[model samples]
Target: MTVERRVGNEKIVELLEGVSRSQIIKQLRPVGDASSAQMNGGSDNVVASFKELIKRQDETIATLNHQIKNLTATWLHRKRFVKTLNEGIEAERELAKLKQEMAERCQIENDRKQAEQPHIEHFRSASLPAVAEQWQQYQIAQLPNAEEVVVQQLSAQVKQLEEQLTYGWQSFEVQGASLAQTSAQLVEANRKIHDLEVQLAAAMSNAATVEGARSQIRDELRKQALRMLDAMLRFLDFITLDAVACYTV
Candidate 1:
C-alpha cells in the first residue's frame, strides 16, 4: 500500500530467495555413504527442523512488518508536526510585518501632529486674546449718549462678536478632545505591538524546542533502524549456523 511496505516486502522476498538458493545448493551437494545413511534415518527430524526455520522466518517477517508500520506512523506524525510549525512561523512573519506597518503609521501620525502644533499654539496664545480685547473695546464704545440706531447696530455687532468668540472656544475644546482620542488610540496600538513582540518571542522559543525534539527523534529513529538491522543480521547468522550444523551431522 505504501512505499515502506513495498520496500519491506522486497527485502523479505530477497531474504527468502537467498535462503532457498542456499537450500538448493545444499541439496545438490554429493554425500558420502555414512552421511546418506544418517540422512535416511533423520529424514523426519530434518523436515521438522526446516519447518521450525520457516516458522522463525515468518515471525521475523511479522516483526519487520510491525516495525515498518511504526516507522510509517512516526514519519506521518513528524510530517504533520513540521507542517504546523511552518504555519506558525508564517503567521509570526505576518504579525511582524503588521507591527512594522503600524509603527510606520504611528510615526507618520506623530509627524503630522508635530507639524500642526505651532498653528494650534498660535491660535490659543494670540488669536483668542486679541478677539477678547477687540470685544471689550466695542463694549466700551457703547456710551449713554450714543445715537439710538448707532447703539442698536453696535449692540448687534458686540453680540455677533461674542457668539464668534464662544464658537472659537468650542472649536478649540473639540480639537483638544480629538487630539486626546488620537493619543489614546496611539497608546493602544503601541500596547498591541508590544504584545505581538512578546508572542513572537514565545513562538521563537517554541520553534527552537521543536527543532531540538525533531533532532532527537531523528537520532532515535536512526538508532531503532540500526538495532532492527543488527537483529535481522544476527537472526540470519543463527539460521545459517543451524543449517551448517544439520548438514555436518
Candidate 2:
C-alpha cells in the first residue's frame, strides 16, 4: 500500500509538471513581441488600406452624386427647352394660319374690286356723259338741283372706293411684316433645339464615362478587400500554429 501511494504521488507530480510546462509555454509563446509586431504591422497596413479604400469610395460616390446632379439638371433643361421649342412651333403654326386666312380675305376683296372696276368706269365714262347730254337738252337751268344731286352721289361713291383700297393695302403690308417676323422666330427656335440636342448627347456620353470609372473603382475595391481577407486568414493560420506548438510543448 505504501509503494502504491508513492507511485501515485509520482504520477500526480508528473502530471502537475506537464500542466506547468504547458502554462509556461503558453505564457512565453512567440505571439508577443516579434510575432505580435508582425501581426500588428499587417493589421495596421490592412486598416490603413481599408481607410484609403473607404476614402476613395467616398470620393467616387461624391463624384457620382455630383454627376447625377449635373445629369438631372441637364435633363431638366433639355425638357424645358423641348417644351419651349414645341410652344414656339405651335405659335408659328398659328401665325401661319392667321397669315393664310388674311391672304384669302385679301384675295377675295381684290377679286370683288377687279370685277367691279370695269362697271364703275363704264358708269363714269358712258352713263355719266349720256346723263349729262340728256340734262343739257332738258335745260340744266330748269333742273339745276337735279344735276347737283347726281354729281354729288357719284363723287361720294368714288371717295369711298378709294378709301377701301387704301385701307386694304395698309392691312396687307402689316400682315406681310408679321409673317416675316414669325418665320424668323421659327428658324431661331429650330436652331436652338438642335444645339440643345447636341449638348444632351454630350452629357449622356460623359455620364457613361463616369459610370465606367465607377465600375472600375468598385472592382478594384473588391480585389483589395479580397486580398485583405486572405492576409487575415494567413494571420489566423499563423496564430493557430503557435497555439498548436504550445500545446505540443
Candidate 3:
C-alpha cells in the first residue's frame, strides 16, 4: 500500500494493541478479586466489582477512541500542509524558469542591436547624404538645356568625323597620284573616329556609374527600413516580456 496508508495502519494497530493489553489487565484483576471473594463467601461483592470493572473498561475505550480521532485529524492537517508547500515550491520553480527564458531573449535582442549599430551609423552619416547629393546632381543633369547641350556636342563630333572620313576617301579616289597627302588625310580621319569612340565610351561609363549609385542607394534604403522594423519588433517584445514578468511577480 501507499506510505501514508501503511503508517496509518501501524498507528491503528498500536492503539488496538494498547486497548487489548488494558482489557487483559482489567480482566485479570477482576478475576483475581472474584476468586478471593469466593473463597471468603462474598458473592455480592464479587458481582459489584465485576460491574465496576466493566464500567472502567468502557470509559477507557471511549478515551482511546477520542485520542485516535485527534491523532487522525492532526495527521490529515499535516498532510494538507505538506501538499500545499510542495505545490508552492513547484510554482516557484516554474516562475524561475520563465524568468530565465525572458532574460535570455532580452540578451539576444541586445546583442543583435549592438551588432547593427555600426551599419545604422554608416547609413545615417554617409549613405543617406551621399545618395541625396547624387540624386540632386542627377536631377540637374536631366535639365532640358544641359541634356541638349551634351547631345549636340556628341552629334557634332560624330558628324565632323563622318565628314572628314568622306573627304579623305574622296581625296584618295580622285587624287591617286598624291598618295602621301591622301594617306595623311586618311590617318587624320581615323584619329578623329578613335577620339569620337573614346568620348562615346566615356559617356556610357558615366551613365553606368550613375545607375550603379542609384542601385546602391536603393539597397541602403531597403536595409535601413528593415532595421527600423526589426527594432520596433524588438521593442514590442521587450515590453511584452516586462509585462509578463510583472504579472508573474
For each candidate, the alpha-carbon lDDT, in order, equals 0.66, 0.65, 0.64
Which of the numbered candidates is closest to the native, going by highest TM-score?
Answer: 1
Measured with C-alpha atoms, the lDDT of residue 244 in candidate 3 is 61
Which parts of model 3 are misplaced by more than 4 Å?
A: 1-44, 130-249
Error of 2 at 196 (Å): 91
Q: What's the CA error at residue 72 for candidate 2, in Å? A: 2.3
Clashing pairs in 2: none
Q: How accurate is candidate 3 locally (lDDT)?
A: 0.64
lDDT of 3 by residue, 124-200 (tens): 99888899988966876888787777677779989976776676556445444444444565566556556655655
Give per-residue CA lDDT, model 1, range 61-112, as digits (tens).
7888788899989999999999999999999999999999999999999999
**True lDDT of residue 37, candidate 1:** 53
Q: Sorted on TM-score, highest at the top, how do the candidates line up?
A: 1, 3, 2
TM-score, each model? 0.37, 0.35, 0.35
Clashing pairs in 1: none
- Better candidate number, 1 or 2, judged by TM-score: 1
lDDT of 1 at 220: 53
Over 4 Å off, model 2: 1-41, 122-249
Candidate 1 regions exceeding 4 Å error are: 1-43, 130-249
Residue 208's lDDT in candidate 1 = 53
Superposing all C-alpha atoms, what RMSD in Å does each candidate have to the true structure? Answer: 43.4, 50.0, 28.0
